[model samples]
Target: MTARPLWTSHEAQDATGGALVGPDWNANGVSIDSRSVAEGDLFVALRGPNFDGHAYVADALAKGAVAALVDTLPEFPAHNPSLIKVDETLAGLRALGIARREAVGATVIGLTGSVGKTTTKEMLATAFAALGATHASPGSLNNHWGVPLSLARMPHDVRYGVFEMGMNHAGEIADLTGMVRPHVALITTVAAAHIEFFGSVEAIADAKAEIFQGVEPGGTAVLPLDNPHYARLAAAARAAGVTRHITFGETAGADFLLKGVETGPEGLTVSAVAAGLPLTFHLNFFGKHQAVNALGALAAVHAAGGDIARAAAALEGLQPLKGRGGRRKIALAGGGELTLIDESYNASPAAVAAALGVLGAETPGTGGRRIAIIGDMLELGEQSAALHADLAGPAVANKIDTVHCCGPYAAYLWELLPAAMRGLRAPDSTVLARSLARELRAGDVVMVKGSLGSRMAKVVEVITSLASDGAA
Candidate 1:
């Protein structure tokens, strides 16, 4: 039996309003990167800031792509038989994604917040996996080109689609969410991330509330009840004509209330009541913040007319994502081991505090001290230094023993640390890695965190490299 196809040249041409220049062909999926293209995939030649995909169309074709969508015709037109030409490629891609979205008629969930957007999206995708084939935004593909690219790649047969909508400025989410037109919209939590652009937390909250602008008629709005801006968000949702709002968190009267949370290094035990239905589930992930992220997932599922119990059941096997919250044990040069919690993907004040809290609850193997290595949380504008310095109090409260700081902003945190607790401070992550390598030893529990621009993952690589490079 032949498998169902995602798109055909005729269908794609109709959807994108583009002209087919060659024989009809079918695509199993869509990809923008030639390096990532699989057999039978549609390769989209998109113009990017640094590189143009048109330069790689032949490369994509050579890689077994079923068809190529390009604004520019290839040099060897007479030789190519699977090319489609469009006025503009990116817009055509968006049109194709929208056409597929409309045709599938799947329940869509759009997630946005300062933090946990990707995590919650993944969790929701996992929950939706119980019902049928589910598709979600890959990684943190919550921005302009990423959203449409992800949408265009969605398999037409998927029962549910989850997309993460992110923005650094106002109006961005509005445009992306409008394309999504989600049946369920969720705000994980309004935070100070990208505050440099928004100016104030309230403004960030206001901007985040824009996700509700695209909620379909009779759709659901899921919000965090524990956030101080809950009322503001609720009002915004109502203004968008969304009557049913599901609030999740520890706050009283929350539609999805957390009754209790016990988070250890290995996993979490959570008891919650969602819409008056109580559920106690064990998740294979830790941290209070993670618990709330899971709650948002369940609330999103319930909002989409799915069973919360089945969604809750899916949480048991949740594994930590790399560069986000993965945990591992690295063998020391002199024997014994150390626990490493990798939060190296990105960082903000709230995220660091949550990571520290998770560290505080962990019992390091055999007489270990909790260590925290932090890099700059970028894009805070003028508040960068003050925000960095403010982390000292939380680090101390979490009982971090030795601390290392990297980047200019992180120096503020280094100075605020009590003299005795300060281990080292480096001008950049590269220098910080060298400084930390010398001091790391057996029986140490270390957590590394920084923003994406800070490139803190290099330190994680160096430390994990020690497992093989350093031994007794």
Candidate 2:
């Protein structure tokens, strides 16, 4: 069966108030990147401070974009390129998103938090996909342009829409949520992820609560009951005219209560109570923090009128995303393989502690060592040094065999770590990646982690490259 077109030329022109040139064409998808534009896609020429998509308009068209949405016409090479000329491409994209949101009947869920927004959004999308056709934000596309781009990409007939909203400072989520107008607003938990911008976690909670501001009339709010800022978020929700609430956590009296969790080599077996009924499910991923994320996701699913049992069952198939606790086995040159846990995406103090806890639970192979390659946790403001130093306790408590610390902030952690647990300390990940790669041995379980700015993935890449090098 032929798929229905996402947008026709007429629809695009009406949505963006743009003048169309060349023959009418239908776009099955929308994209901002010229390099990844797929066949039958509507490419929007967005201008950023560092780069301009207008320069890539020809490339996008030649690559397979059915039509290009642009603020200014680009010079073409002896060909009539289909174009939608608008006053501003960014505004045009936002207009397209607004039109798409109004067109879909999907139950939209707006999610935000200091951490776990991407994981919970993925979980919600996976669970909802089991119930019906679902559309979710791709990766960490939870910012200003990401939110609208995700919305505009949603299929008209989707049954559920899960939009992840993120922020570095105040009021960011509010603007994104206004465009989403979700039926349910979910805040994973308030943490010190971006404490550099906000002086306190309370301020961060208030910023996250902005997700509730655009909740549709009679919409429900899903909150983390165990978080210290739960009350603040609830009050904020009420202030935003959202009265119904669903809370999830290990705390007593939570709407969705996490009763217990058992960790193993494969994943976590979670026991919880939803509303009043007992529930049990297995997540093919590690971390108690993830268990809480699951509860929040299930609560959002429930609030959105989805089947709780089905959603819970679907979680069993959910695995961790790359750079977020996903594990892989790297074959060593001499003999046995070593396990690699990729947590190199982003990190905060709480997130690092949680990762260490997961590391502690793993029973290593015979003669295997539990190794941690840690990069700096960014955006802590005045508390940066103290917070970095505080990780020493979790490392010690978790019984990590060796720790490779990178970045200047991580040096504070290195200084605080016990002499026996210290492996290597470098000024940056690039320096540490080389030494860490050469030091890896058979039967070792290594976990790499850092904030995006820290470039910790380079270490993970260097370590994984051993497999090919060994083969060669």
Candidate 3:
């Protein structure tokens, strides 16, 4: 085989915790999980609070990893050669990422929000791809290790890059922002997510504001005018000395204002005024919430100096992330269609409400009903039950005909809903899903949503299985 994929050995040294020994070898890519290591990959043995990757070094080498960034070398069969010692694997990874960023000089866009950050990252990356070679963080890889891994993965020749930066604690964003030093940053919105970590909503806002700390001097900040904290976020960006600021929303005075939005079976039609230009876009994703996300994309692309028309045109083909409202059509037994709205990846009060709004917009088939198959929202700490129960109001207001629930907190919501609105509730998602599948019929719009920890998406899987087996 060809020589192991090459990375600057010096680059690996700074990114990892230890010293570079041979100075001749390099790595193709950095990997924290040994299972994913491939030939020419640099395996970093990260010892987390609950797990240690050091034990897997031998397996990674056996699998053909080029080098191992480790604090302590694991005993392996004789004749293994790829070992790069490090002090702290995570620190080393961060150093390597920063070193690469300094060397590559790619245009970086930072994105943060309580919701939609991952989807927005994909949207921006898709749009950016139309203009030039681009790189974006995979999934919701916006944490301590994720940030570094994403930055490290960025191709040196990439003209544009997008990094999604997320924080569950107070100082996390500040630390990440400093490392990214983004040229253009976008805050999707501030919602009551991870509120258990902070004392109040204002504290959450303060933490999210930390994304501005990493903005390069004279760089632009993009924010949402419709968010309640819009002014506060804008002020924070300015206080951090951001030289340019842009706003996107349906609200008046936004620099990239969404004038109107119409959703159909095809997708959504967005009329907007951006950079003092009139524009209209037919985006591929569904819902008014997505139109707002598109606005965020527009602002970032424009702030990055790309054409708004081109960005809008590029959004038409963008695919939704699975479990985030990506549509799945299932044919019913009686010659009709059952549309599944998969929002089961995660949820918050704001996101739940938004998903209901999308459900409200969905046009059910003839003689079909709108059903909401929901699970509990996690991470609210003391407010978890109340938040779960409170969703009944939104469900009623949105005209949901039936509500199916699973999980402990979901039981609270089941009790809270009016008698006529309640469909089924079980101690677990399996029973709830079974009941839902039996009751579901053609022309029904079923929305599945809950925190990922609740395992709500399993119900979507069940529905899909039944649809495939001709049981629905």
Number of the top candidate by lDDT? Answer: 2
Candidate 2 lowest-lDDT run of ten: 463-472
Candidate 2 lDDT tens digits, 146-204: 99999999998999999999999999989999999999999998988889999999899
Candidate 1 weakest lDDT stretch, 10 residues = 463-472
Better of 2 and 3 by TM-score: 2
Candidate 3 Cα misplacement greater than 4 A, ranges: 1-6, 14-17, 21-24, 333-335, 468-472
User: Which regions of candidate 1 fall more than 4 Å away from where they truly are?
Assistant: 468-472
What is the TM-score (0 to 1) of candidate 2? 0.98
TM-scores of the candidates in the order shown: 0.97, 0.98, 0.95
Tens digit of lDDT per residue, candidate 1, span 1-472?
A: 9887989889999999888987899998899999989999999999988999999988888888988999998797557558889999999889987888888878999999998888888899898998778989888888888898888888878889999999999999999988898999999998889999988999999899999999999999999999999999999999999999988999899888998998755688999898898899988777888889999899999999899998889878768778888888897766888888899999888898889888877776677789999999998988999999999988899888988999999999999999988988899999888767778888888999999999999999888988855531
**Local distance difference test values of all predictions, in order:** 0.88, 0.92, 0.84
Provide the lDDT at 81 for model 1.
54
Q: Regarding lDDT, does 2 or 3 come out ahead?
A: 2
